[model samples]
Target: MQGRNAGIFRIWKGVTVSQLIDAFERRFYYLRLSITDVCNFRCTYCLPDGYRPQGTRNTGFLTLDEIRRVTRAFAELGTEKVRLTGGEPSLRRDFTEIIAAVRANPAIRTVAVTTNGYRLARGVAAWRDAGLTALNVSVDSLDARQFQAITGQDKFHQVMAGIDAAFEAGFDKVKVNTVLLRDVSDIHLDTFLAWIKPRPLQLRFIELMETGEGNALFRERHVSGELIRQRLEQRGWRCQPRGRTDGPALVFHHEDYRGEIGLIMPYAKDFCASCNRLRVSSMGKLHLCLFGDGGIPLRDLLESDGALEALKTRIAGGLNHKKQTHFLHQGNTGITRNLSYIGG
Candidate 1:
C-alpha cells in the first residue's frame, strides 16, 4: 500500500481554511488518535500508579460521534492514514464502530490500531471486518513473569493468544512493538526475536522515552539501539538496512529470520528532524509535539458549531507550529504529559 499521501502535509500557516493545502509536498500525513486514557495493563513505563491524574486528568474523552467527526475532517484535509491508540484502544466500548467510521471515509487508505493485544484474539476478525488495515501489538517481553511484572497484569498468555489469533484472522501485516529498558527487558531481546522468526511479523524495539509516570524509570534504565543491534549480532543475528516507513522506527532485516526487526532510538538518535506525525488526544486536543506541554482544544470547537473548513484551518495552523524536536535526555528535568494520555 502507498503510504500516507502528500496532501495531508500542506500546512496553512494562518488561521484560515482556504490555505489548508499549500504548494508544499508533505507526504506523511499520519495522525495518532487516542481513543481513551484508560488501559487494562498498568505497564511500568506507561501507567505505574494505577492511572492517576497527570497534567490534566479531568479532561473528558471524545465521544464516538465526535471522534468520527474529527476523523472525517482530517480525512478531507488529505489524512490518508489514521492509527487508533489508547491506554488500550480495545478498552473502548465502540472500537469497532470507530474503525468502521474511519474506513467509511474514502480518502483514508490505511486504518491501524496499536494495542496491548490482550483482547485482540476475540476482536481481530471483527476489527478486520470493520476495515482495519494493520495490527501493531505491544509485546515487551516473552517471559510470562517478566511480562506480568512489566505490565502489572497476568494476561501474558491472553496477549500471546491474541497475537496468534490476529494472524489467523488474516491480518496481512502484524508488527510487534517492544519497548527496551536498560536492564529490565533488554536481556530477553534475542529470545523474543527468536520466537517471532517463523511468523510473518515485524519486531520493533523502542528506546524508553522519559515521559510522565515513567520519567523515573527512564533515568534508572536506559538502552540505546546501537547496543541492541550489537547484542543481536552477538547472538548470531545479521542485520541490513531495511528502509523507512511511517512512524519513527528505523528498521533492519535479520539474515535468517522470517521477518524484520525495527529499532526506534528516539533517545540515542532523534528522527524528529524528519518527523511527520501529529497526535490528537482522546479529548480532541491537537498536539504538535509528543513532549509538548499543551494541545489546542479542538473538541470544544468541533462541538460548538465548528465548521469542517474551520477545523481544517486549525489543524494546519497547529502543524505549522510543530516543534522541530523534543528534549528527552537523561538528567534533563522537564514536566511532560503521560504516554497513556498522548496515545503511546
Candidate 2:
C-alpha cells in the first residue's frame, strides 16, 4: 500500500499474516527501532555538520507507549531481536524505560542498542541493569587525532573509556562500528586489527554507501568492503556462521586474537538474499528497506494497544512490497537523506 506494488498488495491480502516473509521468501526476525534522529557527533561520512531538523518535523518522536505497542506487534510476528538505533538513541530521555518495554516481551530475546558511546562510561551500568543485553559503539578511528578528524569530535579518549566501562558493566563483548572511508579508516586497518587483538570486541567495518546528502563524499571516499574481506581471509581469519537474528555483517574469527572482525559489504553480490531485518523510524514509520522510499506511516495505529492486530497486519502487508534488493548498486539511494534519518 505504501509503494507502487498493487499486485503484491492483492497477494498480501490473500496470504496468511503469520510471519514476516517477503515475496522473495526472506523472513525478517530482527527490527531496528530508531528512537530519535538527533546525533551529537559530526562523523565525516554521516551527519558531517551534525544533526539538523527537517522542516517543521520536530516534536514527532514516538512516545513510550507507542514503542511498547510496536514491539508487541513485532513479537507476535516472530521477531526475536530488537536493536535500538538512532542518530543517537541515548538522546532520548526515557531510553532506559524504552529498553524495559522491549525487554518485557518474552518472545524478544535480544535487546541491543547501537550508540556513539559518549554516555557509556557514565551510563552503561545503569543501562545494563535496565535489561539492555547488547551494546554497539561507533568508533571510526583508534588514533585520537584521526578519530577527531573523522568524527569531528575531540572525545576519542572519552569514547575509548566508555568501551572499558562497558566491559566493567559485564558485557561479554562490545561491537564497534567503523565506516570504511578511503584514506581514513583504510590506512588504519592495522591499528584497529591490533587494538582488538587482546580485547573482547567485534570490529565491524561498514562500507560507505551513497545517500541523498552524501553523494560527493561517497564518490570521494567509498572504500570497498570486499577488499577488506580479502585482506582478512588472507591473514587467516575464518568466516563464522551467522545466527538466525544476526545482522548483515559477515563475521570472521581468528585464533590469534581475542576479538573478532565483521564486514558489512552492502554492495556485494546476493547481499540482500539473507535480509532479515526491518527498520522503524523515530516518527513511527516502518521501513522495509533502509534505502526504501519514505516508508509506511504506522503512528496512528500505534496510539492504542487495541490496534496491535491492525499494526501486525499492516507490517506483514508491507513485506509484499519489499524489493528483492536495494537499488544502491544502480546509484539509487531512494528517499534516505542520511543514515541518521532512518537509523542506518
Q: Per-residue CA lDDT of candidate 1, range 1-344, in tens?
A: 12322234333663222213322322346789998878878888878767764455565688877887888888877676899998899988799999998899987888999999888989999999999998899988888898899889898999889988988888766999988888766877657777868878888899888775566687788777888878776867655553222777766666677777877887665466656567898878887767776788888667743577678777766655554567676444233556787786
Worst 10 residues of 2 by lDDT: 2-11
lDDT of 2 by residue, 1-344 (tens): 34433112222565423357778767788999999999999988889888898669755799999999999998878888999999999988899999999999988999999999888899899899989999999999888998899888899999999999999999999999999999988888899999999998999999999999999999999989988989999999999999878999999999999999999999999999999899999999999899997699899899788898888888888887889899999899998889999899
**Model 1: residues with Cα > 4 Å off, grouped in runs:** 1-27, 53-59, 232-245, 304-306, 330-335
Report per-prediction Cα RMSD to one decimal.
Answer: 5.4, 4.1
Q: Which stretches of candidate 2 lie over 4 Å from their true place?
A: 1-18
Q: What are the lDDT scores of the predictions, listed in order?
A: 0.76, 0.90
Predict model 1's lDDT versus the native.
Answer: 0.76
Deviation of model 2 at 275, angstroms? 0.4
Q: Kindly report which residue pairs in candidate 1 clash with one another.
A: none
Query: How many pairs collide in each candidate, listed in order?
Result: 0, 0
